[model samples]
Target chain A: MSAALFSPAAPGASPSASPGSPELRAQFPILARKVHKQPLIYLDNAATTQKPQCVIDALTHCYTHWNANVHRGVHLLSQEATEHYEGARKVVAQFIGAALPEEIVFVRGATEGINLVAQTLGRTQLSKGDEVLITGLEHHSNIVPWQMLCAERGATLRVCPITDAGELVPGAFDALLASRTKIAAFSWVSNALGTVNPVAAMCRAAKRAGAITLVDACQAVPHFAVNVQELDCDFLVFSGHKLYAPNGSGVLWGRKALLESMPPWQGGGDMIASVTFEGSTWNHVPHKFEAGTPDYPAVAGMATALQWLQAIGLQRVQAHEAALLAEATERISAIKGVRIIGTAAAKASVLSFVIDGVHPHDIGTILDRKGIAIRAGHHCAQPVMDRLGLAATARASFGVSNTSADIDALVEGIVAVQKLFGA
Target chain B: MSDLGDLYHDMILGHAKAPRNFGKLDPCDASALGHNPLCGDRIGVTLLLSQGRVTDVRFDGSGCAICTASASLMTEGVKGRTRAEIDTVFQRVHDLVTGKGDPEDPELGKLAVFGGVSEFPMRVKCATLPWHTLNAAFDNSNAPVSTE
Candidate 1:
């Protein structure tokens, strides 16, 4: 099939079309379920999204049909399995607008993807007195790996600050991109605050300063289209689960030259070209980074997820989520003592807020009683929380399947929490 | 959802709002930090041990009502108790929260507010965090204990 068949939408897709609806909601089996005798309103998409039925079917189909080890096997089942596995890579490449399928490396999710780059590229490229630039709004996954790399290399982690609105401070990236900066790794969207960074601009600044750049797109890919080529970053990463696929699948897309230059992250079977008694020759580019037996079933499911998103058209999905977020921000902000964090002029579908004198855990518990699933805590972005002067906040992130009614339910749940806590 | 009354009883809320022994314990011999990474709930337990007895046991941190209440009640229950006696109370509280001990166990007393924790399995960690910090403080272990 043409890769364009799975592209978001052509020019003719009507802008006024309703992006998400009850019909789209029906495609997800878990949405039909309930918690506490009420229907589940899943507003935790930033953490992980619910898988659609088609994605689940894709996983089942992989095990049912092509249930065999890939790459080296000569049998028909192995060939078919290998075909599906590599085909999934091609789908991911097309999904991200990668230059070649060889640029895509499959791993266990965005965490593993970031770790792979940090261990391999960071180990080789970084040295004493070098610097790795990051933002204050990064998830722990984006921050910790780089911190470890800096510690190992005797380099320092320089953080670009964010405004009180939770957006990256203007000109902070340019100020932090020193000549000794080795690589600048940043999240395309703040997982905690939903503050979308100007990734392309940041990447350009880093590149101009002679530093490599990596974009953590784990939060971005699920909500809208991400063309890696357009962003012009040396690397980009995202997890499959955030994109409505299975949990164990994630994509790490690096420039072909960078992947070839960086040593294989882990020593294993598929990543070796030839093993000598003395030393072994490493495999090429993407395969060099992807070690051990891959999660073939999850990759197959990820392909289906991309196709499903494209069929619905990501533009519409973006519109739908944007609408939900706008409505949520308005309604939640109207509540007394509820302060919305990350009030950037531009944001995605995540709405994080704090109610005066009410702990987020209490809010989460009350929301749970009403069958509303929202995330509470620092959201694995402790630095952001620290910067905001809060221990934690309640977050409601919308996905393509979410609707205005879900936000309404969340507001009602928050009201119930206020009543319970006397906030 | 079990009754919020069961989990967040009036006493639990009262303790959460006005936690007893809630401040720092200066001139303490042993202090340990317990953190629940799942919810970012952190509690610091500081014990001023005099002659092998907890002369002043205080905790300070941010967490849910269950966690704060448990820590507050723990300080109150362990004040002036010997190390051996505190361990016994800790064991009983753990059992009560895990649904393995008597709800009416008089030893728990006000600590019985945690008996409802078994109904919400996830909250057990919140209720038990301060207890773990207390044990860590007793052992003089500086490593921050985690409930994972």
Candidate 2:
């Protein structure tokens, strides 16, 4: 693809003006495709990001060259696979600013990462009358696992409420964090509303309240930088697909001492040090968490994706997406009878809104016909939706590859939807 | 683009905008609730039957345009029809939306406006949730039907 294809600049304008340069966008091959006979305009980045060629090539290379199990066999392929997998762990550790590579455990996604913590650490620490505190803005992935854990352990689940602007109510976390709160978990960036929580403050408060903290950085990691040490959270998790890697690839970064102290959630081949009919000893911290065969290729691809983002620099990606979000919010808000949801003072690139008379599904369908893909639903965060008194909202989430032109197309699509519905 | 127009036909849009019989029926003989968990669309169907015929029917809920319009059209189509007749009509409507039944089938009447829904497979559930709730209501099943 030509550099001009990805350029946000108009004809004869300089391409260097945008953060998502033509060079960056060209690396994503799928961006060249069409949908419904129109150029594909992907605005559903919050769902999953389109992969760059480097990440795709890495996946194919792993399978083609050294398709073998890791940390088991002494053969050449096995050794090579083991090296690649371990090397990817190192890259992930650095990407998220982990103190040690062993702290980075490979999981299917952020959902599994949270479940691992809830089942292992939660099962051990939580007692009857103990509480698990979460925010109203968490996705279902963050909410359901804790609910299951609380049910089994006879623990109470507390929720910190958010405001009409989709931010956590001031002092709500402090109010909810009691001495009996065993764990405090929340998303660094909300998937449904794009609200960026005060993670550092929340973590400190939780620590002072004698609660273990877990940060769901699935949305934050892709848009910006996340350092576990700086945040001082006990555990942090993110999915690779949202970072332009393969699906079923993720990282769970926990404090090394805490991970070592907690028992493994699942047990199988790689997670065991030795097994007898009567008893078994578990492997090290990460391997104990990674049961059976891991998706080594996916891990390798995730590493490549992290490297790709690192090379581009996340600050630039953040700035670019912020611009897109501002543009979308300004344009969409100007339309009569349109209401923007989640009007938080601080947010990421997700722009969710509702029309006065049109349902979100209709807006999604109309946009789909125009080859503009936007998410329209509760975003698996039904509580957030219910808290806001909405069934669903039309969400247009920006990614690195997106441009101002895409936002213009989305605006036009929304206008067409309103006209069709006579709203 | 014209295909989108066909899918959101004037009849469908009209019904979605101002749905007919769009409120709860008090003291109904049989009632059933339908939910599409994927999109959080809910449709509660209430009907009064006499001599195996639907004497009165009303629906109350909020959902996407297709779902709301489907429920509105369904209430109109099922009134005065017996259980067996309603079953046959539902099957025809189902086939019509799923792209199996003939679009020009005279038996379908105004319900044929949904013929375009077949092109969008994901929307088949939206167009059928009301019908499923209607079936459940006829059977007097208290359990809420879900299109997962």
Off by over 4 Å in 1: A1-18
lDDT of 1 by residue, B1-148 (tens): 4577788888988898889999888878999999998888999999998899888988998998889989999999998899899889989988988899998999788988888888788789999999999999988999999998
Each candidate's TM vs. the true structure? 0.95, 0.97
The alpha-carbon lDDT assigned to residue A121 of candidate 1 equals 89
Q: Over the stretch A335-370, how does candidate 2's per-residue lDDT look in tens digits?
A: 998999999989998999999889898899889999
Tens digits of lDDT, candidate 2, B2-84: 99998999999999999999998899999999999888899999999899999999999899999999999999998999999
Best by lDDT: 2
lDDT of residue B103 for candidate 1 = 85
Q: Evaluate candidate 2 and give its CAPRI docking class based on DockQ.
A: high
Indicate which candidate wins on TM-score.
2
TM-score of 1: 0.95
Cα displacement (Å) at residue B99, model 2? 0.7
